[model samples]
Structure formats: structure tokens, C-alpha cells
Target: MTYRLKYGTGTEAVHDAMPSIESEQLSLALAAACEDPIGATEVYGEDDGVMRTLVTEHAIAVLLVGRITKTVTVLQLSYTG
Candidate 1:
């Protein structure tokens, strides 16, 4: 299974605040979530980019390096599975 952000379909405002790297990480995280919707983690923001993280069933944690940015603040996040 694969999950991807429904980009190019939403208002331009979302993209306006998201950096390229953040978008990439968001996409990857979305995909990972599809494989395991129950997965959840605390995501961090940096240099204007987002990151990907997941908590496995074993209670282990995995984090993926994401983009960095200086602009584009994340106002809110709505999780959907």
C-alpha cells in the first residue's frame, strides 16, 4: 500500500507554507502511515521542513531525516487514516 498527500488538489495556501523538503517528508510519512495507520510519533520542524517518524508495535521508534527550512511555519496538522 502507498499513501501520498493529495497535493495539487488543495488550496495554494497549504503549499505556500510548506517547503519542498517538508513536502517530501510529508509524502514519505503518509506512505508509511498507510502501511500502518496505527503508527504515531512526535514530528519536529526544522529549517522550514518537516520530518517522518513512526512507533512500531514493538515499542521501538524509527525516525527519518527530513528537510530543513527557515520559513513556512506549520500552523496545524490534521491526521487522517
Candidate 2:
């Protein structure tokens, strides 16, 4: 269910790849981060310059859960496999 936003998967640098995470996957990714909000996150305020990690069984993705939109706003993802 977790949509993995792979960074530096290939020869390209992480900065070069345009993350292609979807809505459903975004939700799943967020769910994953929520699993361990305390350990996996270093964010506060819930929005406006906040960030969190969406934890999952096999993968983890970093996203910004915007206060107003309530959606996966940003990505700083990497695969753990």
C-alpha cells in the first residue's frame, strides 16, 4: 500500500529525480509515517514549515502533511530494501 518515492534509485542523483507519488500511495505513505510519529518525525505545527515521515512495514517516505490540504504535500523518500 505504501507508495515508495525512490530517491537515487539509478545513476541519477536524488535531486534530479522528480518524485511521482500518487494520491492513494500518498495516503498510504502518510499512514506509514503516522505509525511512529514520535520516532520517525522531527516536525511540529502540523503545517507551515513542518515535515514528517510516513512509516510502513517495508518502506518509509517523508512527506509534508499540509494543515489545510490534508494531503501528502512533499517527498524526501528513500527505499529500505
Candidate 3:
């Protein structure tokens, strides 16, 4: 189970999983480490890119890191399972 926000796929999922309430939403950033998404992270983004957050119904919070592609067109992401 891996979570990432690169080729817009991850971003789209996370962005569309944010809550309506402002305070209810939680946005976090990722650098060296990563947040696993096996059974955690539900909504993903539940909202627009304005506030990115990985929502989890089980009270787990995760922030996936995004990578830029060589063409600069997509954000490519990979995980070693």
C-alpha cells in the first residue's frame, strides 16, 4: 500500500476528498518520508488544490509527495513495495 501525489492522479484523488468545513480539513506536506495508503486515507483530497489533504475515516492523516516529470507535463510517482 503506497500513497503519492504526482501525475495529477494522486492530486485529483486527494483534492476531491477534502471536507466541506474549513477546520475539518487537514493538509500536510511530505519531503523525505512518505505516508502509506493501504487501508488509511479515505477522501484523499475531498477538495480542490487550494487545500490538499489525505483524509482517512479511521482518523489517519497522510500527505503524499509529488514529483515532476522530465517533460514537465505530469508528476510521476513511484513506490517500492
| Model 2, span 10-78: residue lDDT tens | 412432343445434544545554443334455543644446655444445555544444344435554
Model 3 regions more than 4 Å off:
1-4, 7-26, 29-34, 42-81
Model 1: ten consecutive residues of lowest lDDT: 65-74
Candidate with better TM-score, 2 vs 3:
2
| Candidate closest to the true structure, highest TM-score | 2
Q: What would the per-residue lDDT of candidate 3 be over residues 1-81, giving only the tens digit for each residue?
A: 233334345643443454544213323323112343322233335533222333323223333333221111113222211
Clash count in backbone of candidate 2: 4
Pick by TM-score: 1 or 3, better one: 1
Write model 1 residue lDDT over 1-81, tens digit each, in one string.
Answer: 333233222323443455666545664554555444334345544422144444332222223332222212223343221
Kindly give the number of clashing pairs for every candidate: 4, 4, 12
Q: How accurate is candidate 1 locally (lDDT)?
A: 0.38
Prediction RMSDs, each to the true structure: 14.0, 8.8, 12.4
What lDDT does model 2 reach?
0.45
lDDT of 2 at 20: 47
TM-score of each: 0.34, 0.38, 0.21
Which candidate's lDDT is highest?
A: 2
Worst 10 residues of 3 by lDDT: 69-78
Off by over 4 Å in 1: 1-17, 40-81
